[model samples]
Structure formats: C-alpha cells, structure tokens
Target chain A: MSILAIQNLYVSFLENTVVKNVSMDIEEKKVTAIMGPSGCGKTTVLRSVNRMHELSAHASVTGKVLLRGEDLYALDAILVRRRIGMVFQRPNPFPTMSIYDNVVAGYLLNGLRLGKPELDNLVEESLSSAALWDEVKDSLRRRGAFLSGGQQQRLCIARALAMRPEILLLDEPTSALDPKATASIEELLVQLKKTVTILLVTHNIAQASRVSDFTAFMYLGELVEFGASAKMFTAPQDKRTEEYLTGKFG
Target chain B: MTFTEAAKTLLWRQSLDKVFFGVICFFSFLSVLPLVLILGYLLVKGVSALNWQFFCRVPQPLGEIGGGIANALLGSLILLAVAFLLAVPLGLLVGIYLAENKKNWLADCARLSVEILQSVPSIVIGLVVYTWLVLPLKTFSALAGGAALALMMLPVSVRSTEETLRLIPLELKEAALALGVPYYRTILRVIVPSGLSGIVTGVLLSLARVAGETAPLLFTAFGNPFLSLALFRPIESLPHLIFYYATSPYAEWHRLAWGASFVLVVGVLFLNLTAKFLTRRWRVRF
Candidate 1:
C-alpha cells in the first residue's frame, strides 16, 4: 500500500505557480526517486512535504499530502515533520556540536532527554544505520567541523536517522559529496529500505536507476511519468520522458 | 652619482620612510597612552584601599579616621543588582523580538528610540529620573535608584544583544525548524544558547556602564552616610559618595573619596575580566 500520497498539489509564489496539479504515491519500504533538471521544482516538492517551504516569506502550498490516509498539511508541523525527516543538499551538522551530539541532535531538537546509556545506544545505532559508525566511532566527541566533507554528509544522514523517521526525504544528499561517499550513501540507502521509506530528489538519472525502486520524471513543475525504476528507464510510455532520458532536452 | 643618483638617494629616502613609520607608530601609542596611564593610576590608587575593612566597616563621622566605604559598596550592590534584574530580561526580549520576529515600523521606532536614549547625557538621565521618580515617591530610595540605573543599562544590553543575535547564521534556525521543533522552543533552546556568550558579554558591559554612573544615583539614591538595610530607604553609593567627599573641605573625606574611587574601579574591572574569562571558556560547544 502507498504510505505517502499527494493529490492535486499546487505550490505558488504570489501569482506564479511553481508546482501545478502534481500527484504521485510513494510506497512504503521502497526508495522512490524524482529526476528532473535544476529549476524543475523537484526540491520544492520534497521541501513542501516536510513544510520547510512554510519558512519562505512569499511561498504558499495548497494540496492534500496523505501519509497513511492522514493529511500531512493539516497536522501540526512538529509532529508531521517528526514522522517525515529531511536531509538537505548541504551537510549541516551543527559546526560547534561534537560528532556524537550531531548524530543525536534530532532527539535534542525534540527536547527528549536520554539517559547516558540510552543516548549511547541511539548514537551507535543511528551511525551504524547511516554506515558511518565504524568511521567516526573512535573520535565521536571531536568537533563535527573538523570532519572531511564526506564524513559530514554521513553525519547529517545519521542525524536524520536518529529521529527514527518513518519516511526519509533526501534532496540530493550526495550532491555535495565526492563519488566514493556518494556510492557509500547510495549503498546505505538500499540497505535502509528494510526499515524506512525513502524519497530521493536528484538530477543524476544513473544514480536514480541504480538505487530507486520507483522513478518519477518531473518537468516544469509537473510529474510527467512515474513507475517502477526498471520499466521507466527501459520502456518509458511518455515521449517527453524518453526524450529527456535520451538527453534530447532537459 | 649624477641627477639620477640624486633622486635615488637611498640613505636619505630610507631614513625618511623609517622616520615616517616610526612617527606613525609613536602617534598610535600616544593615542592609547592616556587611557593606559589612567587605568594604571586607578589600579594602583584603588586596589591598595580594597581591604576587608572597606567591605566591613561603616563610614565614620566626617572628621574620623579608619572609616570604610561599606555603606557605599552595599548601596552600589543594591542599585546594580536590582537594576540588572529589571533590565536584562526585558532588554533581551525586546532585542530578540526586533531582530528575529519583527521588521516593521514598531521595531524601527524602538531602534530609533533606543538610539536617542543611548545618546542622552547621564546627567540628563539623572534629571529626568529625579523629576519622574523622586518627586512622586517623595524619597530617593533604592527602588528609585535601581529604576534609574535600569533605564541606563537597558539600551546598552538591548543594542548589544540585538547585534549578537543578528550575527548568528540563519542556517542554524532553518536547521532547527526543519527538525520539527516549534519556533519558540527553537529560539529558547538553540538560538539563545548559540548567542549566549554574546548576550552575557552585553549584559556584563551594560552592568559595567551602569555601575560607574554617579548622576542617576545623585537624584535617586541621594547619598545616605549610614547603611540602611531596607530597599525603600535612601542609600549611599560609591560614585555619589566620591562626589560628595571629594568636594568637602575635610582632609579625611578627600582620602576616603580617592579610596572609594579605587574600590569602584577594581570591582568593575573584576566583573569585566570574569565575563571575558567565562565567555572564552564556553565559546565553542554542542
């Protein structure tokens, strides 16, 4: 069954509609990828799901986003966002926070006090799940800013995983990382689907085809085609999707 | 060594440049000299008088020997503590509201008003407080004095806190908000802690500014020679006592005034140094 369903979504800034009448279903325990060029508003769709766009002074969203038949927009954002966590394009692991603290910042962000033992377990579990535990377990107390770029991105993923979010949104999580780190994150995402739903927004069609169970092709704020990743890449039904996949145009 | 060699004149040109740079360094040193001399003089003149008696004994009669600045010290404490209690939270809240929440006309008005208040002379502040508080209250008590000093400290704390809060990156706020933390809790837990060192520094600086002020106390505390335990009673603070005793014809009162000035300088310096030490220790954290 679909865990996340968007119906007739409309997103606008003043009079300009950026996303119009887009509808798609994200299945549970599967990685779904949205592929589009820059300015296609794929990131906007991701951000709107978690309500980060609410912070924008001019942006407004009108749509019903259902998570297991419950409207996400109508729920309190704090509760909604807890169930649906996001990792940004940039690795933002609170520069002053220690690597250990950065991993479990979601708990701290929610004001949940964990006893030392429980906190230690949470830190280990989240980092191991994000495929970063072995790399950073030794110097966990060191400042996060000292980490190399790839480690920082993995640290951000660990932070999101610490929340135990039911659904995770990655807005080009590997865009800022080197190829080695990107491959590591993509490998981790494949393993993560056993416990969580994942939605990835990216421009790399190859990455999407390799990691995603389902793929959605977006163009000019519209969902042009969406299906099983293998079928969509090999036997696309839409001419636009085929042309875009073949690099006829972005 | 002809016309071309004359223009090159290496020794002369080099000596002239060295002299010019040396003179500039000397001028910079000269600019900082007066403050250094005064601070050193205050340290030597003041610290020597900071004996246990200065904090223990009451001021003796005007002509008596071995009297202390205990009454003035206690009065300054009462005034400053109460003033800080009144000013710090209110000023910080307004500053946060201005910097984070509002950018409309009211915030603009508040900014302009604070600017005007900061530029107003301390003597003028004393005059205004005298008319506003002393007249209505019928007595220059600690409350009146504290309220006057609270006014003095508020603008300083607010301006500094606002600037510090502004210096914090917007990305931190966004990160917290994206985590599903409510905005208010995010501010209280994250934003406030992030800017805490700067806020504490601002409060300390404002406290330092308010402690040295004499004019506000002149109209509000009005200088009581005998120590009074009650906040409602008139008080003797160091600055006011200094003004009174320094102007008196008695030789003992003059010595006491210089000693009290010494005490005040040391106390304020210690507070400043303490804040600096604390902020440095906790500058980087989770």
Candidate 2:
C-alpha cells in the first residue's frame, strides 16, 4: 500500500520555484531514494512532505500531499510534522541536553508525562532501534555535544524514532560522516525499512543504489526518471538519468 | 652587511620589544593605582566605625554617639528586591522578542528605545520617576526608588538576553520544532536554557550597576533617618546615606559615610564575582 502520495507538488521560495510540479507515490515500509546533483530540488521535495520548507521566510507551497489518502497540506503543519518526522543533513543533537534527554526530547517537548520506568524503556528502545544503545548506554547522562560526529547523527535518528512516526524523511543524513560511519548508517537504514517507510534525498548516487528499494533521478527542479533500483541502475530509460549515472557534468 | 652590524640591529630590535613590554606593564599598574589607594583609604577610615552596633541600630541624632547604617542597609535591600521583581522577567521577555524577530519594525524600535534608555542619565530617570510616581502618590517612597532602578536595569538585561539568544544557532530551534514542540515551549526549554549563562551574567551585572547609583534614589527615595519598612513612605538607601554623610560637615557623618562606602563596595564586588562564577559553572558552549 502507498503510504504517501504527491500530486503535482509545487514549492517556491519568493520568486524561485524550486520544486516544479512533481508527483510520486511512496510505498509502505520501503526505502525510496531521490538522487540528484546539487540545486536539483531533491531536498525541497522531501521537505514538502512534512512542510518543513514553510519554516523559511517567504516560502509558499501549492498542490496536494496525501498521507494515507488524506491531504497533508490541509492538516496542521505542526501535527503533520509529528506524524512524519524528519532528520536534517547536519547532526544537531541538542547541545544543552544529555544523551538520555536527547532521546526522549520529543516526548518532553510535547509535555507528555510518563512514569520514570516508561521513559527509561522508551529511551532504551529508541536508542537500540537506531543501533546506538550499546555504544552510549553507559554514558546516558553525558551531554550530547560530547559524542563523536557519527554517534551524534545516530542520536539524532534515535530522537526522531522516539516519536514512532509513520514515515521518516532524511535529507543527506550521512553526508557529514566518515566512510566507515556512512557504511553503518546505510546498513541501519536497510534494517529500519522493515517497520517504517523512508524517503531519502541524497547527492551520493552510490548511497542511493546501495540501500534503496526504488530510485528517482531529479535534475533542474524536475524528476526525470524513477524505477526499481536494479532497473534504474542497470538501464535508465531517460537520457538525463543515463548522463547523471555516467557522471556527465553532474 | 658585516656580522657585527647584523648583531647590532638584532640587539636594538630586542631592546625595543622589552621597552614596549615594560610600557604595557606600567600602564596596567597605573590603571589599578587609584583603586588600590581608594580601598586603602576607605579601609583605614571605615574599619574603626565597624562593629555589631553599627549593623543593628539605626542612625542616632547628630550629637549622639554609636549609630549604624542599619536603616540604609535594609532600605537598599528592600528597594533592590522590588526592582528585581519588576525588571528581570520583563527585560528577559523583551530580549527574547528582539532576538527572535531580528528584522521586524517592533524589534528595531524596541532596540533603539533600550539604547536610548541606557544612555539617559540615572538622575534624569530619577526626576522622571519622581514626577511620575512620587508626585502622583504624594510621597517619596521605596517603590518610586525601585521603579527608577528597574528602568536602569532594563537596558542591560534586555541587551544581554538578546545577544545571548542571538548567539544560539537557528538549527537548535528547528530541531525542536521538527519534534512537534510548540514555538514558545521550544524557546523556554531549549533557547533560554542554552543561553542561561549569559542571561544570568547580564542580570547580575545590571543589579550590581544599579545598586551603586545614588542620583536616581536622591529624587525618588528622598531620605529617612530612622528604620522603616513601608513602601509608601520615604526610605534611606546605602548610596543615598553615603551621599548625605560624605558631603556633611560633621566628622562622625564622614566616618559613617566611609563605612557605608566600604560595605556597598563589598556587596557590589560579591555580586560581580557570583556572575563570573555562574558563567564559568553553567556555561553551555555550542
């Protein structure tokens, strides 16, 4: 079943239309990767799903974003964000918060009161799901800023997962990590798809091919081609997708 | 190009560097000389007057012996407490507004007004408050004095809060919002806590600055010789007491003024140290 559907989604910031009339369906519990060069509006499309783009001044979005056949744009942006969580390109774990607090930040911010044992369980479960529990469980009281870059990124993912959102949008989550750290995040994403649908926007084509179930190629504010990962990698139907794949002026 | 000539030039340059270092050290010591001399004079003159009786009893009549600045001390404390209650919260809120809305017309106006208020002499503030509150109430009271001090404190606290919150990255706010936290809660929970050190330092510094101000209290609190707690009646403060006694012809009053000056200096110094300690202990580096 399709969890999210975009219908001719158009997003513009002041005078520039970054994402021009794009439509696609995201399958349930599957990883869909949007790959493009810089300035291709891949990140813009991902932000439009949860209306993250609206945070910027003078940004206006039109058309429909349907989550489970309901218009997402018609709903409250704050509530929509709660149901469809997002992780940014940079790992921004709250510097003032401890590791344990960072994991349960969403609940605390929502003023959701829980028993101590329940909170402990939630924190542990979220950390374990993000594959960071063992590495950080011993030092939960330590500040989030003390963590290494990769661990901080994983902590961010754990924070988002604590909300148990139906869909997760990641905008180049591994772009700042080392090669080894990047590999672990990619492996974690493959495992994560068993329960949550993911829409990933990436400039790294190799990362897209390695972990995605499906791939969509975007260029100059338009989605040029989309297909199964294997088919898209082996035989792209569009000439621009072929050119991008072969590194022709990307 | 001879080796001796090169050595001579090198020696000259090294001597010049030493001379510059010595000059800098001399200026540093010169800046501290006045403070050291004043503290020495105050201690020598003020210590003989210090005693348990000095702290517990109100000032006696001019011819009588053995009186303290107890009334002035209590008055200063009450005036400061009232001012703190009136100023800190409002200043912090205004600061948060200015920081959050960097480009808005309201924020710009608020910033300009705060700057203007800061530059306005404390005496002018005292006169204004005297006319505004004292005249209306028909009394020179601690409340009037406090209102003037609160005005003096507002600019510092507001500027500090705005600058501290501004230093915080926008990403932290975005991260909280992404988790579905309301904007106000995000500010209260994340931004405020993150900038706590700077905000606290701002508050303490402003409090210390206003505590020493005498002109503002001259017109507002006026002066009282006996201990009184009523906010509606005239009150005596440390600075006001010092001002009245220092300029008086009596030798006893001059001695009492020096003692009050020492006490006030110690109090202000302690507050400044606390502010410094808080910045070190609770500083959250982003």
Candidate 3:
C-alpha cells in the first residue's frame, strides 16, 4: 500500500517555482529513489513531504501531502515531522552530545523520559540497526565528534532510527563520504528498508539502480518518469529519462 | 635581460624586505613595552603593600600602617556576581532569538539596540541607572551599580552569542529538528551547548571590561567605608576605591591605591587567560 502520496504539489521560493505540479505515491517498506541533476528541485520535493521546505523565509508550498490517507499539510508541521524523519547530505551528529546521547536525542528532546534500561535498549537497538553498535559500543560515553566520518554518518542514521518513524527521507546521504564509506551506506540503506519506507534523492544514477526498488527521474522542476526500478532503469518511457540514464546529460 | 642586473635588483629587494620585517618586529615590541613597564612598576611599588592583612581587614585612618581593601574586594565580587546573574541569561536568550529569526522585525530591533547600547558611555549608563533605579528606590544600592554594569555587559554578551551561534552550521539545527526535537529544546539543548566555548569567552571578556569600570559605581555604590553584603545597601568596589584613594593627599592612601590597581589588573588578566583556556579546552570543531 502507498504510505505517502504527493498530490499536485508546487513549491516556490519568492517568484521562482522550484517544484511544479509533481505527483507521486511512495509504497510502504520500499526504497524509492528520486534521481536528478543539481538544481532539478528533487531535494525541494523531498523536503515538502516533511513540510521542511518552508523553513526558508522566501520559500512557500501548495497542494497536499498525504501520509497513510491523512493529509499531512492539515496537521502540525512538528508532529508531521515526528512521523517522518530526514537525514542530510552531510553527517551532522550533535557535537556536544556523547555517542549514546545522540542516538536517544529524539526521545530526550521530546521530553519522553524512559527508564535507564529502556534507554539503553533503545540506543543499542537503533545503533545495531544502523550497523554502528560494534564500533561504538565500547565508547558510547565519548563525544560524537570523535567518531570518524563514516561512523558519524551512521550515528546520524541511528539518531533518526531511534525515533521509530514510519518513513525516512535521505538527501544525497553519501555525497560527503569516500567511495568505501559510500558503498557501506548504500548497503545499510538497502538493509534499512526492511523496517521503514525510504524516499531518497540522489544525483548518483548508479546508486539508484543498485539500492532503490523504484526510481523517479526528475528534470526542470517536474517528475519526467517513475516506475519500478528494473523497468525505469532498463526501459525508461520518457526520452529525457533515456538521456539521463545513458549519461547523455544529468 | 642581464644576469648581473637581475641579481642586483633581487638583492636590493631582499634587503628592503629585511628592513620592513625588522620594522614590524620593532613596533610589536614597542606595543608591549607599556605592559611590561607597568607590571615592573606595580611589582616594585604595590608588592610591599600586599600583606596577609590586605585581604582580610577593612581600611583604617590615614596614619595606620595595616589598613586593607577587604571591603572593596568583597564589594566588587558581589556586584559582579549580581551583574552576571542578571546579564548572562538575558543576553544569551536575545542572542539566540536574533540568530534564529534573522528576518523578524523584533530581531532587527534587538540587533540595532544592542549596537547602540554598546556604544553608550559607561558613565552615561550609570547616570541612567541612577535616575531609573536609585532615585525611585530612594537609596544608593548595589542593585543600581549591578544594573549599570549589566547594561554595559549586555552588548558584548549578545554580540558574542549571536556570532558564535551563527558560525555553527545550520545542519546541526536541522539534524536535531529532524529527530522531532521542538524548536526551543533544539536551541536550548543542542545549539547553545555547541556554541558554549565562544559564549563563555564573550561572557568572560565582558566581565573583564566591567571589572575595571569605576564611573558607574561612583554614583550608585557610592563607596561604603566598611564591608557590607546587603544588595540594597551602598558598597565599595576596587576601582572606585582606587579612584578615591589615588586622588587623596595622604601617601598611605596612594600606596593602597597602587595595590588596588595591581590587584584589578591581575584580576582582569586572569579572566582573559581563563577565556583563552576555555576556548582551547572546550571548543567543538566540526
């Protein structure tokens, strides 16, 4: 079943319309990759799902984003965001917090106090799911900034996972990592889809083919093509998708 | 074109560069000369005045050899504590607001007001506080002096907090918010702690600036003759005592004033060093 439905969405910053009339449905427990070149408004579309697009002073949005049949726009933005988590391109673990604290940051910030054992279990489960527990289990009290780049990124994923959100949105999550780190993150994302639906925006076409169950190709502020990953990649219906997939242009 | 001509010109340029480098070093040493001379003079003249009784006893008549500035020392500390309590939280909150809401009208007004308030003379602030608090309360109180110093302290504290928070990447806030953290909690728990070192440096620097200020207290604390802990009563501060004793006719008062100046300078130096130490020890590098 479709977990998120974007209906006739249009996003603008001041006078420029960035995402125009884009519509798509994201399935539950699937990795849906949105691929486009830079300035193609793919990130804007992903941000709109969580109502984070309007954080900019000039930015504005129109139309509806429905999560599980409920219109997310009608609900409080903060509450909507709580149900849908996001990970950025850069790994930004809270530098002031310890590794353990970063994992349970969501619960602490929300003032949801749990017993020591419950918090310990939550941190372990989340970090284990993100595939970072073994590397950091011995040093959970150390500051998060002491972690390596790849470890920091995993800590961020663990931070998001601890919230137990229904959906996770990633915006080019591995762009800042080296090749080996990028490969590990790609593998982790494939594993993460077993627990939560992931809608990812990536400029890396090969990454989309490798990890996504579905692919949506966007260009010039519109969704040019979207289908099952196998078909959309092998036999894209639109000429633009063909050009983008064949490396004619991004 | 000619090898010898090129070598000669290069040599000349090198000599000129050497001369310029020497000039820069000379000026750097020249700037440090006053500090070194002052410390030397204070050590020679003020050290003899410092004794065990200097820190524990109140001042006596001009002829007495063992009068101390215990009252002034305690009074200065109390006034500063009160000012810090008043200013730090208020300034930090305003700073956080300005950083978060850069486009809001209230933020703009606050930014402008901080800039303006920062430039106002310390004496003028003292006068304003006197008119505002002292006259209404019908007394010269430590509260009035603390309010004046806090008013002076607000600008530095606010500017530092704003600049420090601004330097922290926006991604940190986003990361916290993405975890379903509310705006206030994100700022209070995450952003503030991230910028802690810089904020502390600002607070320490501002405190150092106010520690030596005598003009504001001259009208407010009004110079008590003995030690008093009441915030509502008049008090003696180090700088005010120095100003009064330095201008007096007695040689004994002059010696005590020099001792107080030496102490104030040392205190300010300690604060600045602490700020530097804190920045090195605690600053987070992203």
Q: Which stretches of model 3 miss by more than 4 angstroms?
A: none
Residue-by-residue lDDT tens digits, candidate 1, B163-282? 988887776776777778889977887788788888898899889888989988887888898987678889989899999988999877777788888888877888899789868975
Q: What's model 3's overall lDDT? A: 0.92
Please report how far candidate 1 places residue B254 from its true position, in Å. 2.1
Using TM-score, rank the candidates from best to worst.
Answer: 3, 2, 1
Per-residue lDDT of candidate 1, residues A1-250 (tens digit): 7999988898988888878888999999999999998888898898888888888778988878999999998899888888888888877777667889888787877788999999999999999998889988999999887787778878888888888998999989889889998998899999999999999999998999999999999999999999999999999999999999999987
Pull out the clashing pairs in model 2: none
* Alpha-carbon RMSD to native, per candidate: 3.3, 1.8, 1.5
Interface RMSD of each: 2.7, 1.1, 1.0
Better of 1 and 2 by TM-score: 2
Q: State how far residue A245 of model 2 sits from its true place (Å).
A: 3.1
Residue-level lDDT of model 3, residues A101-161, one tens digit each, is 9999888878989999999999999999999999999999999998878889999999989
Greater-lDDT candidate between 1 and 3: 3
- Residue A235 Cα positional deviation in candidate 2, in Å, after optimal superposition: 2.7
Q: How accurate is candidate 1 locally (lDDT)?
A: 0.86
- Least well predicted 10-residue stretch by lDDT in candidate 3 chain B: B175-184
Q: Give per-residue CA lDDT, model 2, range B1-286, as digits (tens).
A: 8999999999999999999999999999999999899889888988888998889989989888889999999999999988998999999999999999989899999999999999999999999999999999999999999999999999999999999999998878888998888889999999999999999999999999999999999989998999999999999999999999999999989888989999998899899999999999998865
